[model samples]
Target: MEFRVLGPVGVWNRGAEVPLDGAKQRTVLAALLLSGGRALPDSRLCELLWGEHPPATYPAQIYNYVSRLRKYLGPDVDIRRQWSGYMIHPGDGRLDLAEFERLATLGREAQENHRYEEAADAFHAALALWRGPALMNVTEFLARAETHRLAEMRMAVLERRVETDLLLGRYAQLVPELTRLVGEYPLHEKLRCQLMTALFRTERQADALAVYHEGRRVLAEELGVEPGPTLAATFRAILTAEPARTGGPSVVASSWHAVRPAMLPPAIGDFTGRAAELSALAEVLTGDHACAAQVTGMAGIGKTALALFAAHRDRDRFPDGQLYADLGGNRGNAVEPQEVLGWFLRSLGNAEPSIPRGLDERVRLYRSHLAGRRMLVVLDDAADDAQVRPLLPGEAGCRVLVTSRVSLSDLPGAAVVEVGTLGTAEAVDLLAAVVGKRRVANEPAAARRIVRLCGWLSLGIRVAGSRLVARPHWSLAYFAERLADEQYRLDELRLGTLDVRARLDGSYLALASQSQLALRRLALLEVPHFASWATAAVLGVPRRTGDEVTENLVDARMLEVTGTDGGRRQRHRFHDLVRVFAREKADHVDRMAVAASRVLTTAN
Candidate 1:
């Protein structure tokens, strides 16, 4: 049996294509194949099929699709249930998508060993596997993501194949092909350079010169920049009747022409703690790992402060200077990557007029500028991996430090560092820094109580300290008493526009409706943490639904997963102020009823 997804998704058995009915079934198969034989959770499948608006009976619908697909696939193939989701097992079957990846890997390996002809052959074979548009029949969200990624990979392979062909001395044969490629990818400097080299080698020096001039004109008109150093060097060599230089240009001491884009926010005056996190981030700059790290945590956890502080400590490591963008993931109106790229390009010395209007072109120009330079890019408050992926430096010499409320697990090879609330000792020190060290030391007991009342949360401690600062006469005891009230905890945590309640509300508002409701019910539990089944009872949902909502809440940081109960169910905890906020939004009757039910269940 053979499975193909490069064109229309299909299953072929014994040289004949099996008839698969409905777009949904084909979509199911395509999504499974794209997973590369790994299990995809039912919730993820629903998102892939229906996007943000999955029907209430989505689980049942998915089962129906799987049942029908099983009949089509026959006895040999298995679409069985895994612990978390569905896994497709193909016995004695060939999948074209898998073959393409294998061949592409071989091509890359061969090229690295300087086997140009063999590399070109492998690349060509990989390209031949694509019959048409990938998964054309499926319009699911994940399917679109997969298709876009595949298209990009295909283009990369084409570019690599062309590079190998030029190395193999196939100059005249590449002229027409290179011409077509340059026309298709006008901003591709490498392709343009290859065309120029081909023209020069074939004794058409004038034509080669014409190509360089045309490329320069197009680049200035479209992207608002001159030809990059490599392409410019190729043109210079051709004009002097010298052999074109192979590979990219060497890093010249061209600091005068380079843009030293330093855009980081100032480090906080009294940033403290996370000694381990700081050390880990510092290692990425000097260590053998790729110069990238992702700092993720709940709002007000000091992710931005940590990133800025770490970047400043390693400032001297990046000779080209730092680039910063607040993606505003928590701010609601998050900045798009394209706009951030434009800002970065301008900061890197590209004139606004030369910056390309298209996203891909802008990304290309931005990466080209950072090619060999040692730089640091800090993308703060990113909404997701997609928002930050484009902002990453293309080469290893540059490092990217990203901060987000949600974990951007999709970033390939990113070192993920989860930031949590400051410890009691660190929180106390932060309070002293913000207020006054002598006052906190003078009233040690009261200061400890105040920080504890603030829940050891960074923003909470800062706000408490600020209030103390405003009222110089007020003792620490007085402030601690005010925050001690659970009913007014969030209220007391507010100081002008910097409200702890407001910050938490942003994280809550970002959640789905079901998760929001579940959080409200879970908050009414009146315990520090509870198991998944207990959460299910409170939310009046099935265990699966409860688990999903609980996970989302954890991701949002409204609820924290404390541990597991007997290794079967997850135990979740809510911060004191967060619980207060949830209670404010929850209905009185619903809260009381769930609370009573939990009591009864506990007693039984």
Candidate 2:
């Protein structure tokens, strides 16, 4: 019997999930799990469970709960009554919280010795235990407090892991996870700094500087303080082409210095394939003649990953630092260019005392700070030209990589790399990396079918990979069979947190009215790829309107414009995940339209 408390308090007795009945009982179990086998006094338990409102008969209630828990454990359980409180024997029962702590400790130790790979592994193991919020089902004061503490610890561990990964040249894989982490904890300076470093390492100097700037603004506004010296120095290093590794002088004495926060887990998977894309991005960052590079691609086409891989490969070149920003254009609430510039200025060592309050002043300060630095920056998921213009760095020494579902033709001096779906080999390699070579080798046909069903898109491949990993008992053939049905493949692919539907919805919500209508109509067609004429026929619009609408969809990354067929023929297709989401939206919109039409007819 394994008592797991890392998240959702439960017991696994002989591999079956056993629920701990009652809220208070569950809370007690959670407390015990979090305490890591330390004895908790009866008084403390009462206080945590009931706070100041303890019942008059609380002692009896506590005893009763303990007795009930003992009974639930059966004869095998050992709960000793000490003078101060109760203690559970730690044996075979695997408490997730305890395991998390253990792995985190190990990760920290590994990092101290520069065993980054081992540290990353330990961090991954620790993070995997969290299915959701810790002690999610329990509702006692102690449980909630413990849950918060554990969650923070998990974040700290994740931060450390990411730092180690960055040092070990895993920037590309770290960016997505960092993106989410930065969004969730905007005030965490260490994470923001590390994210900047990762972006810089990944050859995104402008984005790295932007991260520092963003952190600076959030810190000042939220906490009324400037960024710490470590971060400021990092910014300076980026600007001055100084080495990032500061070995001799400790910021504080080694023992007295606080432990750096843990790194967030990378967005979800190991880097499987996309070597060619990664290489192209690397050349942009590492070439003798530095230049701005933009990686534009259809949604979920691995642009971010490719850019990240490139940055990680050439992280040492910047040494000053790296920075990254999501731009948030993908989600509709894109950060303004001036706001991003202000953030960059602060990150580049502009103190509130010296920093200009005006947007123009901040832009000048930002450019001045970045003038001589060999930094890397990545503006990820950008909206369009307006969102990206002011954020560009002024110096030729700095490398910038921008990723957008839309092309930024308006941005000057950018060597654009329009990414597309992975070739078959890359897709297959990606799946094999996640699911293991043995499994993929055993079921080659099934593997191909799975990737094909995923449309050779990186995000879709990752989602599919995660699903396979989660259901180890389910054979590849079983998964292939499920995905073989075109009607249900999208539904089957909707597994874990990487919901394809959610990503596509963000794109759909950003569309103009006519383009949205065109997208819905296009979903009605069964063809995998369609021509401009075919799209016009489906939408019942003139060829010119149809062409314009398709172009909008292409720009929005809802559809890919593969090529021109003839004099006026343009080939188009929805990415597999996009198609599924579009179809789902189409059904709902069509139903609503029908209902509205009926109401209008009755009124008439």
Candidate 3:
């Protein structure tokens, strides 16, 4: 049996091509094959099939597709369940995609060893494996998502093979093919450079200069940028009658000229705790793991701090450099994706004049720059998935760490990591790191009381420690005594820029008016945990509405779920600090209204 995904997704049994069910089924097969034997979750398959609006019965539909696929594949293919997802073991089956990669790697290694002829042959073999556009017969969404990278890879191989051919002086032989490639990929500066070199060596100096000018014209008209250094150098050599040097990978990748951006902010000095989160994120993000991770938690839960620490912890993994952007999601003045992309393009070595005027153009150009680079993009305080999506690198070899106060599950290929408040010891350790370990050790009881009073929130604890740092005379017991006042706990948890009130205020104000009212009424009850029925009664809405509203608050990171009751009714609670803040809002705004509702309920 043979599985092919380089062009049209196909399953060939014996000598005949086996017909699959449909485009959707082919999409499933293509996804599994591209996964490199790793299990692709059912949810991902559903997304590829129906996009954002998959049918509620998508699980059964996907299962049926897999079942029918088994019948078509016979007993050769091993498509078995793996955890909650499905996996396919190809056994000894041949896959063109795998073969292509193996040959491509051989070509790259040979080229690096200066074996020009061997490199060209290996690259030619790899290129021969591609029949047509990859995954063309799959679903549209899958085709779009997966094909661009494959096409880029093909173009790269062709470019390198051209380089090796030039080194071997196959000048006249390369002219026709190089000309066609230059025509096909007009904006590809490396191809233009190669074509110019080919024409020059073939005694067509005038034609070589013409190719250069033509590229310049197209670049200015289409992309609004001058030819890059490598292309310009080729034209210079042609005009000056000097030999155009065709160097190795370094020279060919000259068109990929952009400054490697070391844009990650300095790690927080007192970055403490989150061992578990750091490990989980590293598995998905650090080193060669190409993935996007959303560190989600309430405001003041230290999402940004965690992301920065994680990125810095493995900073060397991405030798290409790092890119950081603060979308200001929590500040409520979210930066536009277009603007961030523009900044990123400029940072990645793009000249000001070279950046495209529009968002889509910039996205393509940006992805082109990041195609084969190992870089870490740290997006801090993202507003939502949409705001962060455009900033994401469209290729592998780049990892993204996004810190947001809301769930960003919809962000393509993102692993959402929920960062709750610090545990008691972690909170105390954070305070110790902020202040001094000796002081925390001297007053262990006060440290515990202070962290508990601050609700074990990272920001709250840091601010409380910062307050102590500001007043040298203040003792731990005195600070804990100050935080004990419910009305002024938020007031005390503010020093310089660190303010728990301001941090929590953003999440609170972001809520809809009805949700705002629901949260406030819930705060009026003041119980640690309450059932959905309590929410419905307090909000004067149906149980379903109350469940939805409560869920919204949970998603917003304003509420917490404290296990279900004996009857299996889910109960919700607020962070200690949020409870105080919510109750304070109720006191200032809706205390009397909730009191009236309570009186009416008693009367009934």
Candidate 4:
């Protein structure tokens, strides 16, 4: 027997549709389904079904309905009569509404913990169950009200799903759907806000802003009210081009001339693959809410490249200005929070002398300056929590984009996005994107070898691509040959000027000695995924100490806590580049020792 309530309430028993005798009976069944096995009072049901009007034999009528439903439901169904009212046990029957709620709740929980991919899956599952309006056959006023409630819930779930996708950076893919949704729900302020955000992320700043204006006009003409604070703030963001907070400069500015698209440095080529990654990013930005997305990976995995691609795509969204800063958290001269704030204030046109000296004072002034303007700030290579915090705008009108090898969980309400290696196909495309397609096609096998040798690191691919671009006479086969020599592969890949090693070194130098050692030890594990206990075993330290070390690594972007599954198992993994670095740092003997120990400890 299948009882579906996600659309019209229906029961399929023994291959036939069980006729629900009257509107009241259907209403009773729906009410029971909504409550999900919980008892609802007769009075409440009466109020819901008949409102102020009650039939002369209301009690008798309800009893008769329950009796008839029981006959159809058969022995498997449990219809219990309680003092308050009644309860229906759906048993093993498929109830769409019940499943929908369950999946929605699960998705929400996953999102809260930063498991975006999983959350998207859960939400999609929930949404798929909805065939159409809930209880479409029923005409009772109470049924109509319930139907409306379910419809609203469906929208909310869809919005959440979109939000998860955006956080994953799936902006481009979501644009079409969001456009339609925005039109369908023209008066819904929240939906409008999401549409604007998605449009902005896709580099359609003008369109995003247009959506806000259209929403304002619709609201005024129909409801006689201005846009609410959320919508208003988003509109202001559109006007100023506030960067969504990923953490860097709220805007990027160039002196001497206006910055044009052509002026930006070309991202590393041979960018073989990251379609999934890019799609995930678009999804979060277009999803139905503002999110703080964190892009983290090991040094030289192209975290910056991916972030830059996303920024460029959405650059038009932040018209107030685009800000970029290297926080120096990973290596080199760490850019202090105060220093970044000062630079940001100056970029906003605050003169050096006018920029506040005190940290708190500067933060206040910075936020005050950005109060009503929409700006986009990119804090690249963030060093630590303190370095990024003061730079965040206080108003909701701005967007910040932050990129780090470390995880910045300390940054409250920020969404964390982890970047991994490019897939084989993306690697090939990236190479093609950078080096001419003709050259790659001429030596497809050699090109594949180069990609694998580069470990599909964006930085490595770019360096390899740059080499190919600069040396026109060199064949792809030659580059592959050089990478094949393990002893000098890293050195060979290290072009004197643009070196991925140097970039990674900067972040490594910033770490404390113990943390660095812990990172090295982590390289010993063969398993791609791990937990605190597994990490602890590798470090030869207590679980708490291991946790602290792992946390430090996470902050530094050397590792990411993917999520907890089942019970106590908290999954963690290093970005492919980081893993490569760890392996490079470990000699064969040390690596073997660590791996063996981890295995034994985990087994016990």
Q: Which RMSD values do the candidates have, in order? A: 5.9, 27.5, 6.1, 19.2
Rank the candidate models, highest lDDT first: 3, 1, 4, 2
Best by lDDT: 3
State TM-scores per candidate: 0.74, 0.53, 0.73, 0.51
lDDT of 1 by residue, 188-289 (tens): 776788888777777788998998899999987876778876788887777777674456321111222545878988998899899999988988876645
**Per-residue lDDT of 546 in model 2:** 70
**Model 4, span 165-199: residue lDDT tens:** 87777777878888888788776666677777777
Q: If the candidates were sorted by their TM-score against the true structure, best first, what order would they fall in?
A: 1, 3, 2, 4
lDDT comparing candidate 4 with the true structure: 0.70
Q: Which digits, one per residue and each the tens of the lDDT, describe model 2 over residues 150-238?
A: 55456666766776777677778878988888899886656676777777766688888888888899777865667665667777666
**What's model 3's lDDT at 211?**
92
Reference-based lDDT, each prediction:
0.79, 0.70, 0.80, 0.70
* lDDT tens digits, residue span 281-343, model 3: 898775333368888899898898899999998888888889999899978788999999998
Off by over 4 Å in 4: 1-288, 521-539, 542-580, 583-604
